[model samples]
Target: MSEETTRGRAAVSGVAWRRRWRVPEKYRTKGTARPEGGGRSAGGDAPAPIRQWPLLLVLATTLVGLVVTLADFRIGLLIVGGALLTGAVLRAWLPAVGMLAVRSRFTDVVTYAVLGTAVVLLTLMAEPRPWLEVPFLSDILRFSVD
Candidate 1:
């Protein structure tokens, strides 16, 4: 091909490539919705650790609980539940919780609280001298089994 023709083809191909990779106008125009309390926990200029304190705290607590569970199941479970409960509390009260904010504030709080309560309750009701004894639960289990 002639020099001019080759250059023209190259330009056209470049344009085509750009068009193929470009974001759709509709999606580009639409604004993204940020999860509630999704901003940094600390100031914008804060260090990474400071900004993500909430997530770190929850994860650290969970890790500790898991490690403890290796030695003592009940206490470890309690600690895990407490960590989840703490996450719920922080999500509820903190204006910005960084990565801890996974959804709407209400949804996150409810999810965390429910999960924490369930864990703690189930742990307490574990076999062999259960701390929480629900008479109906035993009856229900028996009925279901029989």
Candidate 2:
């Protein structure tokens, strides 16, 4: 082919390449680069707003539970269970919790509640007093130990 024909073909191919790989309209331009302020750019979907208070409360409760663990192990387990229960409550009611809100709302709430209740019950039934006993748990522990 002639040099001019080759150059023309290259130009046509460049345009065709760009046309083939064209970005979707929604992601074409992010709002951050624009001088005029606006909400999020991707299809106008607003970012999840940060909720500080709930996050702080969860952190504080967890820290307190950790501190309690230094004194009495069984009571500390109860305190940790209480923290988990608090987290479950927050997950059920709060809209956004930054990092704490991991999984779907229903799953998170149920998981936290169940685990917390189990911890509380197990701690209560442990060792000396044995306020509430579960035959299955004792059997499982005995099997595991042997």
Candidate 3:
């Protein structure tokens, strides 16, 4: 082919190359960037006007449990319901800790566990099932026969 024709073909190919995306050198191996914020980068960074989602989930779950309890619900509802109450309480208190600059995920987990335990204890105490009883196994009786 003549020089002019060759140059034209090359130019066309270069344009086509540009049209196709080329991975930048930096991202050739690794993945996406972490959020640029200091602590707990929001999956969504809109001003959360009300309770955070974890808190809300907890609240919803808890409310469901309460409904079940009133409607003569099941054990799952009670357990999950107690959990939700714990969550609501955590939602209330977590931000307070965060205000002191301890907003790490670990702290969040520990707080949730402790609060959830308390909630469970309170619920058990609040009202217990009539049929639920601690069984004493009489089969293996230990008597001070001496």
After superposing candidate 2 on the true structure, give the runs of residues whose Cα lies further than 4 Å from its correct spot. 1-50, 139-146
Candidate 3, which ten residues in sequence have the lowest lDDT sum? 34-43
lDDT-best of 2 and 3: 2
Between candidates 2 and 3, name the one with more favorable TM-score.
2
Ordering by TM-score: 1, 2, 3
Q: lDDT of candidate 1?
A: 0.96
Q: Estimate, for each residue in 1-146, the C-alpha lDDT of model 1 and write its tens digit.
A: 89999999999999999999999887786677889889988897889999999999999999999999999999999999999999999999999999999999999999999999999999999998999999999999999999
Give the TM-score comparing model 3 with the true structure, all chains together.
0.34
Report the number of the highest-lDDT candidate: 1
lDDT tens digits by residue: candidate 2, 40-79: 2223243433234555677788788888889987878888
- Choose the strongest candidate by TM-score: 1
Q: In model 2, which range of ten residues has the least summed lDDT? A: 34-43
lDDT of 1 at 102: 93
Candidate lDDT (C-alpha), each: 0.96, 0.74, 0.52
RMSD of 1: 6.2
How high is each candidate's TM-score? 0.79, 0.56, 0.34
